[model samples]
Target: MGTINDGNTHPGATLPWGMASALPHTKDFREKANGPAYYNFGDEKIYGFGNVNLSGLGCPVAGAVPLKLSTGKFDWDIENFASTYKDEEAYAGYYKVTLEKHQLVAEMTATTRSTIYNFTPQNDDKQPINLFLDLGANTSHRKGGSLKVVSPQLITGSQLDGAFCGFQKSTNIYFALEINQPNPQVKIYENQKVTDKREVKGDKAGVVWTLDQLDQGKLEVRVGISFVSEKNALDNLRKEQGDLSFEGIHQKAIAEWNKQLQKVDIETSSNDDEQIFYTALYHSLLLPHVISDVNGEYYSREIDKVLVADDYTRYSTYSLWDTYRTLHPLLALLYPKEQRDMVVTMLEMYKEWGWLPKWELFGYDTFVMVGDPAVPVISDTYLKGITDFDTELAIEAMLATAANTKKNPTRPGISQYIEHGYIPIDDRGGDPQKFSWTNGIVWGPVSTTLEYNLADYNIAQLANVLGKNELAKEYYRRSDSYKKLYDPKTTFFRPKLKNGNWMESFNPTDRFFDIRWEGSGGKGFVEGNAWQYNFFVPHAMNDLKSLMGEEVFLSKLNDLFSNGEYDLTNEPDITYPYLFNYVKGHEKKTQQLVREKGDLHFTNTPSGIPGNDDAGTLSAWLVFSQLGFFPDAPGIPTYQLTTPKFEKATIHLDDYVYNGQTIEIIKTGENDRYFNQFTIDGKVREEVYQLSHQELVSTNELVFNTVSERLSEVKE
Candidate 1:
């Protein structure tokens, strides 16, 4: 997992929903040895530390503000400042490393928007302790930036970022740094020149502070991060970490992590399985970061102005196309309050940008993926009873995005979709490639049709919740449009032209059968073949069963596993294992497949994750599967049940949004591949395959008596 193209996640020392993630700045600062992610686990030489790098994302954006504590030297080159270190340690909200070259120890901990550093020189020698701030050493390409020396102990600056996958350029980050040393000498470098001015502007500048006197050879520093202005950065630093020592900040960060991690408690005998589960849990909590400061002031790229979040937190960095499937659902379930803010954040974006983000990064919609995913995420969150946002505005935004038939940013080729119920393979109406998302021609029309169906059904659900039955019916019909693409001859969802004719060549297994959208291969399906993407009509699975025949549906579902087409690295077919429950007498297959896939793909190693976690989509799959249920159908408010890995696992529930304080999922007989019976508080359930949202969270005890699949039959 090198932070690009696949499931390589870096170690992030950021709290849940924290903006500043302190990571090791390895020697790869010269290039993207690991994309925009700063840490390279295999690299022995670390230059310093950086903040605001993302973890487990398919594409990288910013790895900004690299700083190091060096002594007896002042060089602008990264090689001069780079040092080989050993005994590296990393955890949630905390990172520690020993620099062998500089003979110093560096430890970092973070608040929501700040980083506190503690540096101790191993050999003082009475030499001046040099603090190096490399404003030009970003892993992403440099644009332009500015820096100002506020005083001997403080400095404020900002750097231009946002080249996410060669698209979008508005993720500029600002920072304010404060050191504990009093009356220190400052040396500024601009384009490799030791400048005499107190201000430096450009991408080729760095600042060095030489201090001969320190409090017992210990250097303490705090950095506040902001996306709006430098004043907000300094204000964030002053209020957030006021009077907190290095040790105090480190302990507070650990305590914050514990508070979030303790929301779920599990009883498992396998330490490896437990470690993997918690690691996944930690990763799941790292995204959709809060970008607003304590004063609620943030820059809105949609409006090109700084606005204050009056009653809620403003968040950015939404990988919606990837996280909409399961991550948003998980957040809605466990973190409803925060999820409500996120929904409001999207709604605010709509009010200003006139469209929901396809893949929003740092307040800008990159249009990185196909379809309107924000519909499912926001609709799903609202449908789950998290109604703290504007309802009328939400409905208006969804209707606008869904009904737009011309030059839509979220949904391209929408007019073709409306006229024919499905987009044609040859329709090239919208921008061929908006921004830098490499969608050739019409941008995966077959897949976009399916994606729009899911999104439309989610909006229909939202509409139904508001007693708008007629409006719900309209979207429901739109949702069933995926049925038009089903090829009876091939028994798969094939690409059809505008005139109701199939494409001349149909190869279901050819990954790159047609054009590509960015790195997501395949023409008809983004990053998937027909065998993987054809089962995407979760909203109309009954219709799919009728169209493909129940036997064909089951056979094709089984073929995914038998032919190795069940890609856990991607999202299209991740829910196929749970789809067995939709068919009769196939519940045991779901149980076995879910457990096997979880154990096989998810482990306690660096490569334990099978693919791009896609902003914790796969990790949320593991968390849900290991805890014994999954939100298989997006925006449906239903969870498909499977075998539980733990004997007893308790999940904290929202008292206001849900009916219970805690819900326990207990597996009684054994941790095995199959289960024989399912009950809620000793009462047998007629429908053992799934549970409604109200029914699942309100229940106190949901038990699954499992057994080994020594018996491999579909039913007992």
Candidate 2:
């Protein structure tokens, strides 16, 4: 659907999702979609408690209890006015504020190994009231955990019984404390697993839970968490705050964050960019939430794991190879029923772990980072139909984990990266696999095996659109082994050798940060590099512009989007500045290089994010370039348009869907890139118009003109 009859001749920027505008903090029902402790599920408020011991397992002693955040200044700048704190509170655990002149309380419990925080001061009465701990805040290594001050009158009640907190892998975590006092017993000792340059003496110890004896009124505390024993920390305090109190377990954790922020219903008028886009979509739905409870159960405690005892939903520390590109494709477009319960939690972690997770946390998969990137974010969210699972057992567990990570030759550097295209530099792929952090990332040093052959050619085009045509022609012949490590005399996409020759001092501007090895170890690789991943083989950008032509691939795609040294901060340079909308007339230079890279590379604060946002995969490329259309080529379903950040947008997919969309961005301001003119849904139409994905989930009407002078006239 395209159109235009205004003459200036640029009918290239397509975007129509009209009459939809709501998300301005869904109209202050406690305003939050951003700012104020980051993810404010519209403040129905439930600070934190991932698995405060419901026994379904999951607890490094998580807790963030701040519900209303004092209402305004974007909720006291989420602590910074109180002065600084968003380093994602240790994977979002520990945080408590009850001040009015200090009634403060903090508790982070664990101890299957380490991590313990217990700060209590009811009235400051007898005076010893200073308890503020950040301890390497948001972590860069405080290693384990500890803080003490116990003695509710020389400690009684069985010396504070079976204490608790949680977390074990990625260098353990634990915590414990007990007090029912008035106020006045102080001790502050934090041990990040010691070793302050070898002088180990008991490295550092704690558990002295004292606030003197403040009992000025109702000062009770007894938190718990455990892997097993300390009687599972009084059975996770009788399955979560038994006999509630602590404001009824912090109002049942703000009614479980208002039932996961009432699923989604935003409106928007700019209440501070809808509180930073709904608190970054509420910190992107609290880490693959529900790590298991409601009896599906959980508990893994890492190290050559086993024992994941589940019920149904068990998503642990899933960095899902960087939040399955664009935080699970915006949770399959605004939670399509939790994207069909996260593809039934990835076919229940490939039926209790046999191979699926490429970076799991907690219940251990920690194969940590790098492609196998959960197969192009679970096969482009089950081929955009967001399946309700068992889609032929999720395509035979992604064709048995991409044919066992491509025929496992003791996978680790994965069978010389599917029989050599690039991995070897000796020691079977040299020094810590060229340091994807000492053997973690096997490929992805600019052209991460072309993002693993374009996510194995979109998981073999979603196994031939679900029919599985012989496992989609054997993964489209292992996705055209990237034309056997293409070199065509250094056109780029290096690393090959084994007599093929290319590796030695190959410096494509040493984009690999430190010795060209890929993905983030090459800091700017997995996120960006080699001039934004050699214009990301966009399924071979026109066979790489016929070996560099069309005026040297449009001046190397306009200096890779106006070279201020491009790093739109991750996701292989997110469609590298909309690769001038697939070349042809250059669609008004892809709508003026996406509004000049969202106005000289974005800005809204907290370092207005730029790199390592691999969580919402760079905010799903700003929700598909603010909805103009751009899915360059993820197993080719269809999408390609430019310019859209809302002038009108309506997308209400529940209750028998309704799309009433609209986007009126025709700002040609004429600088010239591409787009001539035409019309559709009204018929004036022209060429180059790929839209599919069921005409973008059933469309309605779309319009655009924006040519600001440049029409020598050429209509067929």
Which numbered prediction scores highest in lDDT against the true structure?
Answer: 1
Q: Against the true structure, whose TM-score is highest?
A: 1
Candidate 1 wrongly placed segments (more than 4 Å): 1-6, 31-34, 125-128, 430-441, 513-519, 708-716
Cα lDDT tens digits, model 2, 311-372, are 34455556665566556766665565655665676566666665566655545554544566
Models 1 onward score TM values of 0.96, 0.31
Candidate 2 C-alpha error for residue 142, in Å: 32
Please list the residue runs of candidate 2 whose C-alpha ends up more than 4 Å from where it truly belongs after superposition.
1-98, 105-115, 122-315, 321-355, 358-372, 375-452, 457-478, 481-552, 559-572, 575-716
Worst 10 residues of 1 by lDDT: 432-441
Question: 111-217, model 1: which lDDT tens digit per residue?
Answer: 89999888888775776778888776676665546789988888999977766766746657899988888778888888768898888877677788888878656
- State the C-alpha lDDT per candidate: 0.80, 0.44
- In order of listing, the candidates' clash counts read 3, 74
